[model samples]
Target: MRFSRAIATAVATAALAGSAAVCVPASAATPSTVAINAGGSAISASGTSYSADKGNIGGRTSTTTVASGTTDSALYQSVRYGMSGYSIPVTNGTYDVTLKMVENYWSAAGKRVFDVSAEGSAALSDLDPFQIAGGKNKAAQRTFTTTVKDGKLDLAFKADQDNASIAAILITPKTTATPAPAPAPAVGINAGGSAISASGTSYSADKGNIGGRTSTTTVASGTTDSALYQSVRYGMSGYSIPVTNGTYDVTLKMVENYWSAAGKRVFDVSAEGSAALSDLDPFQIAGGKNKAAQRTFTTTVKDGKLDLAFKADQDNASIAAILI
Candidate 1:
């Protein structure tokens, strides 16, 4: 995919502000690293050099003492508040992104609720630094892996309650691996995004006439197939797949990446015009947000087509991947 022209325009603007928005090539042999202090000046700590405030929008700096448990307190001491987000330039590749944060203003949870998106896809939803770090001045960090086909990684922060803020940013390149072949007698589909190969199984990119929307948010735990669960199709009515007339076991992978509570999302699944799973709550089954859960059922396809229907009881229906 070609780089977004809007990103190129932003990078040109960052150039006038003395920001590090240069497009640098990154490879496996010598991968490039990026570190930036959100609202502070340039500094070097722990043998890593951090750039000064750059590539940000509509924010100011605030200095405060950071609590223990982290050696790099300077990184978390100065934060940029009231900013929309950041757009940093880099070569097209996959990178591991880490955001350093602290709740210096609010003491209790729910005071600051926001979401983090990378490349226009959800990376984190409803994040609270105070609750995650156990205190106001404590450090809280969130990390995720995302691919960047464009020449830049655009991050957006939308606050639900309070103003959005961040202390520092770290972006490191990752080595790409060879893709594996798909297994026979099994059809795997990454429900709402690009194709992915994981756990010796190759899943193709999402393709079907399903009536719904798609999302790309990373899941926290409970499975090694994070790529499979990171993307999903939500608010769908049903999907139909052509198959041989035989009995087959179908697995529907799911995760609740939006809501934290259990009763937020509930749905039912039916296969071949019969009940397969009744009232499936992903958050309740997985115990929390950003966790993986699944449901499997056996059905006989007599009409040479496997029909799967989903009906929502709560928010909406969501599915990450499908296997048959």
Candidate 2:
């Protein structure tokens, strides 16, 4: 499947910002040797059986290791030109994943392209090593954190414009604590915008590093009724709030602080694709600029998540706060 251009842009932007965005926690990375291989039998020259690459003999490429932390230079040839990564044993918990690669083939970009997904979430979209490393025969390392829940943390390399290849896969434990079966009452960000902690909640679409998943644009704590106002998140068009399968009252705290005039700010809000609010205008509801307004709608969240999708008419959509 193809990657969403919007999500790809969001992730690429975050990567350039050195934030890893929703892909990883902001902590020092230390990847242990989970598995590594070039292409062949599940054995390396150094006799590292656990780290051999499950290979597609037809797609094997010859490459030399740069001698950084690699165990076997010849063992780095096990390329998964076909098939997804699940040959190793894994458990539920946070992990530091490091995909080691050196340009063994292809001199320029677009020669090799693939999509990477970890634990059913997009880690990298339209990945091209030649582009990431600037050229072939060079070394490049892509690191991120992923949590395994279903016995094994699946890392799939789906063919994009071209085949996906990996010289080796390194997975290291992040923390000693076991992954929680279910998180606490999902982060219902209170008023007054501040940086959203990555450890807070699992996000989708609009959910980002700063604001659940995306960075929050505004924090309304003291300007108006500080008691009523809180932090607000705005960025992409779609967002998902993680929650257990159940029904709950979803409240929206709206403010006409940004757009002063009517029709200047118009958008649609939906829950599970059903129209909850059509052509919602905060300025109209609040009656004037810098006024506070709110609306509430109750809906059931199936699949352990509540999707909040927005579409703008005149300007971008916003959320001052959400209370569950």
Candidate 3:
């Protein structure tokens, strides 16, 4: 028996600069059905094209079953036996796989027992087709829902008693994944303030205080200022940003509003006592005063926090925000 395929629509939304956009994929392909004639020759039936003995080439048994399926179809007349099964080509996604079987040579349960797996995941174990179909030479079926992302569907059979056999195969496309859930808050800091929170992330500047830093200062004209960049700090002191011990992407949000050129406010930055940004100058990156500059680097933090220290070279160092 065959089942109809139905797909569910998914949607995702992204916000940038106070505006939103909706996006979707190019749409997935229809389900692919590959019917294989287990041990027999190939022929199409019931509007489905059948492949002949594509897998387990040398493991085939030439013996034809004296018993025949009551359905009186060519597919029910022959079958193949093997220790391992086949690998069918497919696209990346979830699918529904159906295997058709008929107990031919083995009329007893334990005479031909085996296990089945789909793409390395367990599908069935200790399978006894003869027992499942009520002890005889009859037709039976097993179905499983699985995901295929590595470009193929592997139907593997490991024999426990004698060997495993199959008569036909049916594959159909299953529903795709829906949009992911909203992300958690990010971690960040407002230079002189206690903690700044936004976009599912939190920022803080309350680990160790750096001298010459003011919590009530404002940015200069033409400089970046928002909820995340409201406060400003200037000095040549070391400041530690509290964060869980691990590797993180660190971003230093700054502006050269106080200086007109690169060499005026050069500073060396270190995270966890390691040099991350050496001789970094916002004016050099943005090319002028009152322009914003952002520097990003990766570092490892230990002992439940990250330590960020700044050493001034030519002039005093300044920062508006720190994001992790």
Report clashes for each candidate as comma-separated counts.
0, 25, 9
lDDT of 1 by residue, 1-324 (tens): 247888888888878665443344244334478889888989875788999979987777899765535788878888998788898987778899988889899866668878989999899887777655645787787788888876788999999978888888898887667665543377788888898997898888887636999988654556777878899999988988887788887988889989989779989899989988766777765657888877677788999878889999999999998888
Single out the weakest 10-residue window by summed lDDT for candidate 1: 20-29
- TM-score pick, better of 1 and 2: 1
- Candidate 3 has its poorest 10 consecutive residues by lDDT at 5-14
Best by lDDT: 1
Best by TM-score: 1
Q: Of models 1 and 2, which has the larger lDDT?
A: 1
Badly placed stretches (over 4 Å) of model 2 are 1-33, 38-50, 55-78, 176-324
CA lDDT of every candidate: 0.81, 0.60, 0.68
**Candidate 3 residue runs with Cα over 4 Å from true position:** 1-29, 62-68, 175-324
Return the clash pairs for model 1, or none: none
- Which residue runs does candidate 1 get wrong by more than 4 Å? 1-31, 66-69, 177-324
Clashing pairs in 3: 39-79, 39-80, 185-200, 185-201, 186-200, 186-201, 186-202, 188-202, 188-203
If ranked by lDDT, best first, what sequence of candidates would result?
1, 3, 2
Best-to-worst ranking by TM-score: 1, 3, 2
Pitting candidate 1 against candidate 3, the one with the higher TM-score is 1
